[model samples]
Target: MRFLIDFFPILLFVAAYKLQDIYTATAVLMAATVLQTGIIYGIDRKLQTMQKVTLVLVLVFGVLTLVLQDERFIKWKPTVLYASMGIVLGAALWGWKKNFLQILLGSQLTLPTAVWGRLTVIWVGYFLFMAAINGYVAAYYSTEDWVNFKLWGYIFPVVFIIGQGLYIARYIKDDSNGAEKS
Candidate 1:
């Protein structure tokens, strides 16, 4: 349910693009994001930071794409978002000596400090890689291609998550004993 709600904007954007054009798609995306955020807030009574960021960026860039009659702004939004995430994660791990992934999810998933550090590095690298991929596709590809890339690009995250889950499965503790199996 929540996944569909969150993805409503992207789905709408793609549909609008197919039906009309980029400017129309941008407007639909902007409106859909606003509505999604509002609906989430009404249901949950709170908004995640990323939800807010998505709303703001969609509005800002979507409007730019509509008002200026250029699709570049909307195309660049994902790259900017991915780069910001990478910078923040890298700074927290390297500069502050903090494993943010552990800080955020430590209670749910217990692991050695080394594993947490490695997970952090993996996340940072993934974000950087995604940012580069988005930038490259947006800069060099046609609008149709970029839209197609956005749809297909979801696979990268799915693969990353599955791969990470597999990697961490070996580290999970034995449920009966509450001790990690060696």
Candidate 2:
């Protein structure tokens, strides 16, 4: 259910693209993202920082894509988002000596300090990799190819999330017995 809500925008965008064109797809993406955000806010009662950022970026870039009649803006949106996330996480972890991921999720999951630091570093690297790959594809590929890549790129996140879950599983404490469980 949650996954559907989260993915419907991209799914709609792809459908719109296949039915019409990039401009139509951009419009659909904008509307779907707005709807998605509202649904999430209604359910969660508040928006995460990333959710807000994503909404704003989608709207801003969607409008630019429409107004300027340039699909590049929409295509590059993911790259910008991924790069910004990587920079923020990297800067917070290295320069400020603070782990933003830990600060955000610490209340929900208790992990050793070192684990948090390592997790943040891993996230930073992942974000950077995503950013670079998206940028490369968007710049060098045709619009159709870029759109296909967008549809297929779900594999990267799926794999990363599964790997992350496995990595953290051993450290998660089992509340039933107050013992760590893998």
Candidate 3:
């Protein structure tokens, strides 16, 4: 459910492109994103920080898509968002509040500080690379190619990152039982 909630905008954007005209799709996506954010806040009884960022970005990029009548802006939205996250994570890894990534992901797993810093740096580099690729594809490649790359390019890196995280999690032995056995 949380995953679906987080993915609501991306799924909506893809569906909007498939179901109707681009402008109409943009409108539908904006509505769906707002509704999804609202639903999350309603259920949790508190607003999430990411909800605000997602809502603002969706609205801005959706409008950019409609007003400029170019899908390129919409395509670049994720790149911008990811790059922003990368910057913040990179700063955190540099010792400016090391808890940043942990706060975002700690519910799922715990890791040593070195692992967290390494993961953060990897994410930072991934975001930087993704931004450059997005710019190149949007500028030089065909629209169809850009869209295809946008969809497919994201999958492999995400899968690889998750796999690496899982491997790290496995090596993070449980400490709770040590005291009991001692």
Highest-scoring model, TM-score? 2
Candidate 2 lDDT over 1-182, as tens digits, reads 98889889999999999999999999999999999999999999999999999999999999999999999999999999999999999999999998999999999999999999989989999999999999999999999898889989989998999999999999998797755552
lDDT per residue for candidate 1 within 1-182, as digits (tens), equals 98789777888888999999999999999989999999999999999767888788889888888889999999999999889888888999999998778887898998989989999999999999999999999999999999888877888988998999999999987686655553
Q: lDDT: which candidate is best?
A: 2
Which lDDT value does model 1 have at 8? 78
lDDT of each prediction vs. the true structure?
Answer: 0.89, 0.95, 0.75
Q: Rank order by TM-score, top first?
A: 2, 1, 3
Number of clashes found in candidate 3: 0
Error of 1 at 44 (Å): 4.0
lDDT of 3 by residue, 60-179 (tens): 998999898987777677678767777777877675767576778777777877777777777778778877878788789876576567556758576867877786876577878997
**Candidate 1 versus the native: TM-score?**
0.87
